[model samples]
Target: MSHAKLFHPKTPEQLKRAVARCARLHSGTEAGEGIELLQTSYENNAISWFLERAKELPLGDYFLWFRKASGITFEDKNEWVPELPVLAGVNMAVVGQLKEIASLSKGHLAVVSNDGRVAVVMDSYSGFLQAEPSPEEIVYELAFWNSLG
Candidate 1:
């Protein structure tokens, strides 16, 4: 069932839909406790770690330099493990969705998931990533989505 070679860049709208499909698939798992953990995590406590060591270099080599130094792989090439997919699908989809909506120089408003997790990482090209709790919040959503499956 591996299709790792088939990976492609998914659009925000497509990723949003794929994430929804994954969420629905997750819902079918019938694991209420599992579902609830992500629910609570997304709803209340998402943490976004600001990497002082991972800042963009003067030459716009932030990601390259950071990858070589810290190795956290924040915004490098987002590849899907088509063979052993994480969260069955949601994480890959979310990475794609978040990249589209959050990583750009002029990022869009927001992207939401079926589990009710919301993300808004805007205006990041000019500087490093900073987390601010909106009238709502984020990494709780990230951790929740990451924790699924």
Candidate 2:
């Protein structure tokens, strides 16, 4: 299942280059096939568009969530579970994904590559740069699906 938080590479620039290499490699000359296991979906040669946006995306703490029309956070029941924050006057919500998050994650790490695609990875023998929309479109996409329900 997709996690409730976001994660990215500890080394953004290096990861960016790795993704570029993934794009340039001859078809079937790829490294990560199990990249599909990283997230929920897979698309071959899908890194181009995401790479463009993520290329210069500076490392920053990015927290993307949807504030319900009622202002309840996480879109949970309004009166049932009042534990979730109101998301309105809150001075600080939970900490967001930090720049060095990769190192901090024990496993099931989520790395947002170029643009918004996410690669939930564990360093494999093949390589990185496995990306997809597979619920990996985080932050700006954070509350995306939640909105529909």
Clash totals, every prediction: 2, 2
Q: Itemize residue pairs with steric clashes in candidate 1.
A: 46-139, 46-140
TM-score of 1: 0.20
Which one is best on TM-score? 1
lDDT of each: 0.24, 0.27
lDDT of 1 by residue, 35-118 (tens): 222222222222121111112111110010000001123568543221211121233322333332233212212222323332
Task: Supply candidate 2's per-residue lDDT for 75.
Answer: 53
TM-score of each: 0.20, 0.19
> Candidate 1, overall lDDT?
0.24
Task: Give the best candidate by lDDT.
Answer: 2
Runs in model 2 with CA error above 4 Å?
A: 1-11, 24-26, 37-149
lDDT of 1 at 18: 35
- The number of clashing residue pairs in model 1 is 2
